[model samples]
Target: MSTADTTQSAVVAKLSGLDRFLPVWIAAAMVVGLLAGRWVPGLEGALNAVAIDGISLPIALGLLVMMYPVLAKVRYDRLDTVTGDRKLLLSSLVLNWLFGPALMFALAWLLLPDLPEYRTGLIIVGLARCIAMVVIWNDLACGDREAAAVLVALNSVFQVIMFGALGWFYLSVLPGWLGLPQTDLAVSGWQITANVLVFLGIPLVAGYLTRRLGERAKGRDWYEARFLPKIGPVALYGLLFTIVILFALQGEQITSRPLDVVRIALPLLAYFAIMWAVSYAVGKAAGLNYARTTTLAFTAAGNNFELAIAVAIATFGAASGQALAGVVGPLIEVPVLVALVYVSLALRRRFTASTTEAS
Candidate 1:
């Protein structure tokens, strides 16, 4: 068998039940949520009844559950190693922070100019960088695992620091400067910070502490091989749970406005394609090996949708269009990124052949 074929089989072997059919699970969750919201009496009211300072308690729990396991998987100790690689580090920062967000902003406006709520939501999605699933994509495509880990950690720190400021700029300030219509989000930087703190901060700190303690007590092998597998599935469960609740809250809007869902999806589809393609080209030009190039591409292309969804629902109510836009994010991202994984592997074979010829 070709090396690519072997790698593909290995990836398939590694996929857990939750990870293998994530798109299917997400679709099912959306359907279940829509049905419950539409048919079940008082389901929406019951979900909305318990709020933690205007955020639904059930949703908040789901967000925390989704975020914790993924963050906990990050290798916080390896940051120094990746940071020392200036080319990889700088290229990643530029692609993720600068190029990724700007591209999404342009796409959101260019595509959904009339739909302000969904537009704002897409822009918000842009600012939230990837911290979770890039690891899986990277591994599946035979990318650099350590690079993915360190990069995810870097993105997490930047996420805490930069998300609110960027949100304010993209949503409020930048539009006014450019004569585009401003978002009606009505949120301050501090409010965004507070919401991020409650949603992202709590889980981030918890994940870090869990990793630190787990490694110290049981050693890295046990923590990774034994403990991580135990907690790993929780992230998907939490994601599906959150999606169900989100759709349940906004089912009427989503089911009724199918076209709007398509509208929200276009920019997302464009964003992933452009970001991955550009990052891959850049990685190749910068003299990266195929593995590191793949790592850079996936990391650059992916967004922290979990964070995006949490921020959207927190700032705008669960039923808001902004939240709906966020909900549609994973629905599009899961399938698209999965396709990119195959693309990356196919390119890997060509990449290997060319390198072999050159050497």
Candidate 2:
């Protein structure tokens, strides 16, 4: 075979390996964390103690590492291109900021109203728009990487502001509307701002600088082909590390109330499915290219659970049911989104077939 065919074959094999090993790695992380939590109970506390303003310093660092590589792919210079596709940009903004939160509120309120802490946790997760994991999902679906990066950066900024304001409003003052007692939580805007900056601002700056400096020193082709491919997996590793830490920290609660995890996941699972369908349909109707459509769908459907857990722990105690709910968010997220990855791939084939026929 020609070198071209050989290279294509190699690339296919690599992707297949990734899909096969992805679940294995996730399961290994889960087992290690669970075993550590069960056996070495002191370890979780040791990690948790090195905290600042309700955010664990170690986990915060892990999140920064997870985020930077994803952001580095943005080609900050081409962010203007996202503006050229106003339909996708506007559609994502409307759905993420408006419809998404309202839908979560309705579901959490309708389904988990009796359990206020879990309900509050769900609301917090809803308010925290995803900035990191959506890239992975979009990539899995063969979506526009550039568009996903720009939307993530945009969502990161918007969520930093909206999370605190909306969180305080929905979780605190709005209880009067529901005739429920105000959640006895004091949310400091400054603390939430600090968490957002630590988690998002640091990585965003680092990612842009890494791309620019690498390109200046090594050229664009080397930066993309050599440097990015090496660092890209860091995001997934960091994510698994964060998950382990979260699970370890809350092992007792997780072990004791298995059903509570399920309860929290139910609304979230529904939210993911419904949000994906709506955003996908809207994007298709608006005539977005398949890449932009899938990016919008995954971005709209994803939640920034890291920020949710931070804000929850800061406002409520770490062991609070609200915090437990935040922990469960990631537990349910992995398997559910993994399934969606396959679904997205399957749908893409149909989408491509239809577009080809039309052309």
Best by TM-score: 2
Cα misplacement distance, residue 48 of candidate 1 (Å): 3.2
Report the Cα lDDT for residue 343, model 2: 71
Q: Which stretches of candidate 2 lie over 4 Å from their true place?
A: 1-16, 172-175, 178-185
Reference-based lDDT, each prediction: 0.81, 0.79
Local accuracy of candidate 1 as per-residue lDDT tens digits, 1-359? 97656655676677777777776887899889888888888888899899765567888798789778877876778767767878998999999998999999999999998888899889988998877566657765778766876776677777767877788788889999999877645434554444556666687789889999999999999999999899888877887897788778767767787888999999999999999999999999998989889999999999877567667877787677888898788768876987888788678777766666787
Q: Write the per-residue lDDT of candidate 2 for residues 298-331, one digit (tens) a residue.
A: 9999887877887788778778888888888777
Score every model by TM-score. Answer: 0.79, 0.89
Model 2: how far residue 182 lies from native, Å: 4.5
- TM-score quality measure for candidate 2: 0.89
